[model samples]
Target: MWELRHRGGGGPGPGGEAASPPREGEAAGGDHETESTSDKETDIDDRYGDLDSRTDSDIPEIPPSLDRTPEILKKALSGLSSRWKNWWIRGILTLTMISLFFLIIYMGSFMLMLLVLSIQVKCFHEIITIGYRVYHSYDLPWFRTLSWYFLLCVNYFFYGETVADYFATFVQREEQLQFLIRYHRFISFALYLAGFCMFVLSLVKKHYRLQFYMFAWTHVTLLITVTQSHLVIQNLFEGMIWFLVPISSVICNDITAYIFGFFFGRTPLIKLSPKKTWEGFIGGFFSTVIFGFIAAYVLSKYQYFVCPVEYRSDVNSFVTECEPSELFQLQSYSLPPFLKAVLRRETVSMYPFQIHSIALSTFASLIGPFGGFFASGFKRAFKIKDFANTIPGHGGIMDRFDCQYLMATFVHVYITSFIRGPNPSKVLQQLLVLQPEQQLNIYKTLKTHLTEKGILQPTLKV
Candidate 1:
């Protein structure tokens, strides 16, 4: 669309004399023959004059090379494919890295929790640092300090609640922990109050708005990171499925989407994620659900993958059991009309939990990616390319797990609503930690209730 008709003059202008200098907002009028006839230095000066004539500040800037996907990957490959410039090499390398990440996660329950914690810390840092950078613009006092202090308070409150709920026995067996177990809420409130008072004291003239903005920013970051991560740990207590299934599903969907987009992408999915395409989104969804079912089936048969982490003092080590819930147990369900006709069977058997996995995968594909979209919007708002380039081509840890925290929340809620039951084992473990008086009282109460319901043994009734 651009035309460069102007060049060094061969002869003249409209008057057939020497050409005049171009006025402002006008393209130069000239010819090339005179420029070639003259020295090369004169031609270079004329070219510089053309460049200086126009205002280029209004032109849109190309984003930094480092921020672009191709450049990031090329650097990550250490300039591999420098000649042929194969960009897909980076995608393959990323896949290899992700495969290794899951391998470490599969090794143990502690490793899974460790992974979650690591992601949480990195995500929190990314968000808070963004807020901190903006805070200085407002000249706010103690904003960084207050934000981190609130983070600590919130984490303490959440972790305390988690331990008291999930590890009641652990808390009850220790006197110091018993006190915390009794008054955890009051202690948490006190810590929060301390931070609140500090914020109030730190407030300066005409800076209330900035302080409030930072307060909300810190809280939102905590919600996105600490709160959801705590739920992931709680899911671990239920079983690994609540943690593993959704995470794997999301990762699968992301990978499949990228591959699909790479090959067949045309229509954009959204402005926030410009590289995302309709082909990728649809492909990732179907693939995620199918993978969800298969993974559920495979992981269901394994004790370590299916069982909750529990203490085993007799063996002096933590262990998992193979007694899966009825949800995880295989059951027969009548097949659909087409499926039944194709298979020539009345029913096909599968873990009922696998059906639930379809729901998990649905959320992972459809809703979980919104978390990443939100992160994209956040970065755009700040004019940042990535949160940080912690990974070679992948941006940051937060960038990788933006969808994961949302997926973790969904899995936790799904388990609580559908799969979890009144756990008799957890209740018994709790009962074992009570004083003898309390334990006897509970026993009597249980016995009388059972007798009234006609469930007591005749020999023991007397």
Candidate 2:
């Protein structure tokens, strides 16, 4: 009994000696072998007791619990307690960043594309780092190198497609770029295959499970970071308006949700984000819709906002000078019965695109918040504070823009499915890339079809 007490309760003697104090009741003449074995057992326990017990200190610095600061402190800080002060500081900084972003975008679309690529790379870094820190315990081989190689391959595949799709005219004209552009997919696949072979070669017989786990992790991270951001750049090519409006709408919604939640939030919305409230959700939706409408109406007047983006080779720049599509043009619509009765107007004229803001804003407020919730769940799953403390108060760039990426994707899909039509310029650019004989065949077919429709005239002496 005294031996057990000595081995468990007593840890170490003074002067860094690995000695457990013998209890007063124990005999001094115990076996040397037993004493040494007991001492070693005690030493092992002392080293790892806290980790084994899963102490509070071992938990994530920022926990899964809701932001639940005391009422007294909140009142003391004038309701700016529990991260609100941090929120204001970050918010101001964010607005400044947005202003600078627009200034860069004003310079050229190329600059904006560079900004997006930089952000994509940074976000990928934050996520991949988290996975490495979490799963590196598996002792997987070539994990970091393989992840980076996959990122390179994916970026090459995506950006190459973008250049080919949007800048085909410039590509076909360049002798050096034609081969690369024509076989971009094959090149991307070949690069990926090389990486795949390397990963297989690095796999150990005993570590196959760990190797496969890291592989899936790398691929999933790529999907989340790369695919969504690609859609965002695609939205930019449609016109800066599509990109700006949806992103701004999400920002507006997030701000209003926090404002409303702070003042009027009572009923919790979700367990994942316990501070969220139904009041905040509804209030933000209404506010976002109003903001989207006003913003869309004001921007439609500017060619820079309403015009489709087109490359102007003659001017050696990108330009937004196309005639407003019917979507941007004003059209008559019947009002609701109540509005019609109150205003005594049978019909009202409004920019048709302004009405579309309702859908965009609706998604921004409703479905977009789920993206944030999804991110919250991901952080919680990893037992992490933030992906990285990229922004002091808010968290990482991922934390701030989780919903914005979702909104951008939705906007792109909405425009393509419902609003976008085939572009004559793009069609002509593709035709220009074909052989002369092939071009002649298309021309003959078009001429015959147009003549059959009485839209083309036969040659006649003037």
Best by lDDT: 2
lDDT of 2 at 362: 95
Candidate 2 weakest lDDT stretch, 10 residues: 48-57
* Per-residue alpha-carbon lDDT of candidate 1 for residues 248-291, written as tens digits (9 for 90 to 100): 89999888988788788999999998989999999999999999
Q: Which residue window of length 10 is worst by lDDT in model 1?
A: 56-65
Query: What does each candidate score in C-alpha RMSD?
Result: 14.9, 10.2
For each candidate, give its TM-score against the true structure: 0.78, 0.80
| Candidate 2 local lDDT, 1-462, one digit each (tens) | 344334466456677776656743463778767777766666654543333344344544433334443445345557566567656665666777778877986887768778888888888888887777765433677888889899999999998877777777777778878888777889999999999999999977555655676788889989988988898988888877787789889989998998898889998999888889999999999999999999898887778877767676678778888888887888899999999999999999888889888899999999999999999888877787667776555667788878977887788889879987675555765787789999999999999899889999965769
| CA displacement after TM-score superposition, residue 424 of candidate 1 (Å) | 5.4
Q: Name the regions of candidate 1 deviating beyond 4 angstroms.
A: 1-93, 137-139, 422-441, 459-462
Task: Report clash pairs, candidate 1.
Answer: 8-31
List the global CA lDDT of all models: 0.76, 0.79
**TM-score, predicted candidate 2 vs. hidden true structure:** 0.80
